[model samples]
Target: MERPQQPIEHWLDLERDQLFLWVPVMLGLGVSAWLWLPDPQAWTSIMLALVAVALLALAADRGGRASRAVAIGCAGVAIGLGLIWAKAERVASPALTKPSAVQFEARVERIEMLAPRGIVRLRLVPIRMIDRPGRRSAAALPAQLRVNLPIADLPMGLSRGAVVQMGARLVPPPPPSVPGAYDFARVAWFDGIGATGRGFGPIELIAPGDASGGELRARLSMHVRAQVAGGPGAIAAALATGDQGAIPLDDAEAMRRAGLSHLLSVSGLHITAVVGIVMLVVLRLLSLSPWLALHWRLPLIAAGAGALAAIGYTILTGAEVPTVRSCVAALMVLLAVALGRAAMTLRLVATGAIIVLLCWPEALAGPSFQLSFAAVTAIIALHESPRVKAWFAARDEGWMPWLARQLASLLLTGIVVEAALSPIALYHFHKAGLYGSLANIVAIPLTTFLVMPAEALALLFDLVGLGTPFWWVVEQALRLVLAIAHAIAAAPGAVTALPAMPQGSFALIVLGGLWIALWRSAARLIGVVPLAIGAFWAVSTPPPDLLVTADGRHLALRTIDGEIALLRDRAGDYTRMMLAENGGFDGEPGLLSEHRFARCSRDLCIADRVIAGRQWRIVATRSAYLLPATDLIAACRGADIVVSERRLPLRCQPRWLRLDRPMLAQTGGVAITLATRQVVTVRQPDDRHPWRVPARAAQGSDNLCCSMQGLAKQRQL
Candidate 1:
């Protein structure tokens, strides 16, 4: 005790006390990589081989500490690979490969109202799949399918447990719209949904579902809707039953732009608020009763109550990955409090992440998992640092020191979270909330102190059939929250769009963030180098000049003025959003105007540009197969590039670059570089992974000819 602490002699002499915390993070990263491999069987064999070697190394114990460390690393890798293999096996099932009309009877497990789309999305569990009416088959179908039924088709109100027979066209979930975009098919696969489609004929309801959790959730949602109607009502229903389908699109966009979208989701913040309020109220009531207070350990009792509250809330919200994660963390913290130990530590957060990753390995590839853990880890690392603690201790004492300290903590926490999540937000969504901290300062307090507690009371009253009055109070609080969100989103520069960063750059940023957050010494500052490099690369990457849709039905080109001009106005929302977001353009897609650089007609649209003193003609047409012979000849006469919705004849454009249905299907969307005349498809051969279905080969070799000719011709010029 009398000896002074010795300074760390080497940069590598970092503390090993918290080294175990990194085990889960490393394993998760490895699992994520394994999931993206092109050959799952190969990886599985490799992992097994590594496990055997690790076991042998442990048995021999030749190199002492170094060998032990190597063995531990190998064991971690093997575990990660094994978890990924288990997940793949569990979710494997027969999937719909082509569109087919079939009569199927299914029980409606849940109904989500897509108000904007004027349809209801039903989550149905298959009862029977028939090739025809009254005919049964041994053919396997997906465990579940999300079917969209038009509102008018559902003349009878749809409810949970309602078995219905209907004729519908079903197809597998569509692939990603663009490279590195969100993969809905993969998400569906993990959710046990193999197909999606819309009902064509009338839906005949048979038997109502028995009283189940889903039915209860439906009842609660209907009650919430009946008690309160409009935007606030929709918000209330979401908060109560976790059904967010009814939320207006405009309101949702406003919340996202203002960075208050987390308030809408049932996450750690909402769960903690509900549990903390319930615990505080219960503890206060217990403390007033001297007999109980003297006989029982009050802190332990309160912690137990809070943990139970968190669990109840989790169940009410469907216990999704994010909700389950929050519940796990809350329970761990409450357990610590019950044991009279410090709770807010990196180890606890890591433990919660480990549990979540083990339960849902696929979640490692999602933004929510990454952002949530990054925020928590950064905050804990910052607050628990000696320098930060010393700084707080040195602050001058003044009136209301406790209040001042609390406010400072809140402000710093907001700042830390935003800083930690900014890169991830930019990488995934291509938009950063510039005023996130300012919005949080106003929104978080209101949401925590007034809104959630009022909601809890309203829910209790609703159970007793006296919820209307308290529901009005909750609506009022929600109105204020929405007003704040609107004001913030309306402010200038509230949300800034950034170009999509390269995958390598994003990887660097993530690695750098981990280094800075996980290390305990001053040498951790070295992480800033990779962070800077990633930032520079992200900003310097050039945008594509031309964009072609997967179906070859739409084309968008970056004009000389830097605006993205669509060859046609109509396109799917996903395709439009991907182009706009990646191109760093905001708002709606711009149509190619006849008065500008392009000429358009009923069936054809063409544009021209001068690149390096050579006139390059771009042509887009509807239904190449339907084009008249004369019109086709005229269109292909002098075109440098042609894009069409149907396959073109080889003789039609022998010397020109052509993109048509078959080529687009094989390559997905294509992006062109004007300077080098380089073409990049959204799906390259190297990007083929085992998670995606294999693509069929295109019919023609015209695309190959174009590539070779274009390069050779460009060099001659």
Candidate 2:
């Protein structure tokens, strides 16, 4: 007698299979929300509430559709709350508010040479902080500090695991440069770096550290550098040791523009190559022995070897989040093989994501995690779609059918990955690599077939002291890869700029992507609604009318004709580049040289215009400079807004709005629309969050009269 599988049982099985895929997504969303909470204590209340709901769901009756839904909802909440707790534990630390000169001994964990900038960045573990002269205690300080050392001052033979004592002025990492911009402080917090600063003087080597694993990795990087030379050598070192700082900035930028930057990083592709090569070699060798081949499960044995090799590769590459993610994915495949189950399923991807988030929830906010997972998810979804499979099967078979199939697969995979990642790339970097798919068509095969294999063989040969020839081969492949990147990047309009999407719209886009990728039925088409809405919103967003830097050191105003006019010439390149890229400016009429409407001298610049039939005058000055009272009074009388680096002591009409250092420090930056008289300020919500380091206490009150008189007298110039 045979029993038939009931429809309800089949449906339940399908639901169970799909349910695991959404767990990580929900957890990531909750973690993002948790990061935005104004107070850390608020997570406690949230956790309690979520736990109650989860318990209620858990207590629901089983074997019903509603029960299954409740169970899935409960699982998602539990995962989210668990991640919130994990993140809180990782970021918890004492605040470092004030800046002070402190002497400390530290072990160099990592060192990066910024050749273009002539600086060396060191990641250090603090041994001791001297609170006062001639007195030191091992009292708790920040776990780590990222210090910059000028090339001229860098000590000789500086290497990882070497202990050094040095004096430096340390300050808490600052908040974001602009609203909705990357939060360096939050990132530093999770990375265990409490402060950042420049070393003041010479660094003295206190003692040599035992050659640890990190030291060995550094030695390997140095050896790779020695084997190769110049920029290619640096690229080889990056491939060998995951120290990307070796690559030149310009080349890195080119690679990014060409969408080939992933080649430099040890990610999924590299992991898979390593594992696949090892597994194939090991399996072939095992099969050669008849006794073992007959007794053992060859596939399982090969998978085990692959998993081990993947783990080794991950460790050798510093076990970064991406490496960990790739390793997890590889291991999941191995596990499925060992269990005689489907190996390449979305469930495996979801399982990998859950593991990564559980171990390092902070990665949820990073672009690498998002983009990598998105690419994988989309590829799996598209490749497994019945319609896509049927369509491909229906295509005609021509000459060289196998080669045609392989090439078609590669091209389709590239297209799917690019489509999946474009929104995220535009949202994060504000640039779209238009030729990314074409570049990948050439790059993916070249790297997978030639570059990575050569590097792996070289490393293995180096262990036996016979790697020179292989290293030479690696250098040649690297040169070709770099050439490809440069050629692609040199293409006209290789990268296009897009305006930043609103947070709400970005959320919608993310939801749409998930819906399309995760859903199994025709209902997935509903995702197009949100995707279209997000795209429309992004295209419709207008550029800001006025731009100001956080330090109040530069200002730009939009002319009536929609051209940007710089208020000052010496603004920082970082702020200028970010603004220019986000505003979709192109070549011709450069950001710096175009629209010279504002006139400037050593101390002052002024511009005037009529907006919406209202006359608006703008005045800007440095704090150290002086202006004659007659000029100042007259300017204030006519100006609708006055902005200065420091507060000025001129009585202005009530209609005049003053923006100075104190105000700018709080707002970070501002954009004003002259038509509606609406002011939009860049103030990050996290600036006021409880986890942020408190600002230093205010100094004494200002003497406006004395400052004004001094300015008047200095006007004699």
lDDT of model 2, residue 373: 92
Q: Which residue pairs collide in model 1, if any?
A: 161-209
In candidate 2, the residue pairs with backbone N, CA or C atoms under 3 Å apart (3 or more residues apart, or in different chains) clash, namely none
lDDT of 2 at 183: 65
Candidate 2 runs further than 4 Å off: 1-16, 40-63, 78-82, 130-141, 392-399, 463-469, 556-568, 571-573, 582-594, 608-617, 622-637, 650-657, 671-688, 696-717
Q: Which stretches of candidate 1 lie over 4 Å from their true place?
A: 1-13, 41-70, 130-140, 155-157, 393-396, 399-405, 462-469, 572-574, 610-616, 623-625, 630-637, 654-657, 676-678, 686-690, 694-717
Model 1 alpha-carbon miss at residue 589, Å: 1.4
Estimate every model's Cα lDDT from 0 to 1: 0.75, 0.73
Q: Report the C-alpha lDDT of model 2 over 296-366, residue by residue, as the tens digit.
A: 99988899899998998788878887888888899888899899999888988898888888888878878
lDDT of 2 at 520: 81
Tens-digit lDDT track of model 1 for 1-717: 532222332332354655667778667766866865556566767787778878887986744444455577677777877787678678876667656677788988777777767888888888897676466553555788888888888747557778888877777766665554566777787778877888867778777656477667777877777777877777878877777878888788888888888888888788889779989988999999999999998878888899998998888877788888889899999988877788888888888887887888888878888888898898899988888787566466776986787778778878888878888888888887888887888788888888778877888886778877788888888888788788888898888776566777887788787778888877678889998898788877776667777678877777777767777667677678788776666666688753377888767878887765666788888434377766776787768778888877656662446776655666666777666676666654433343355232232334534544553453344
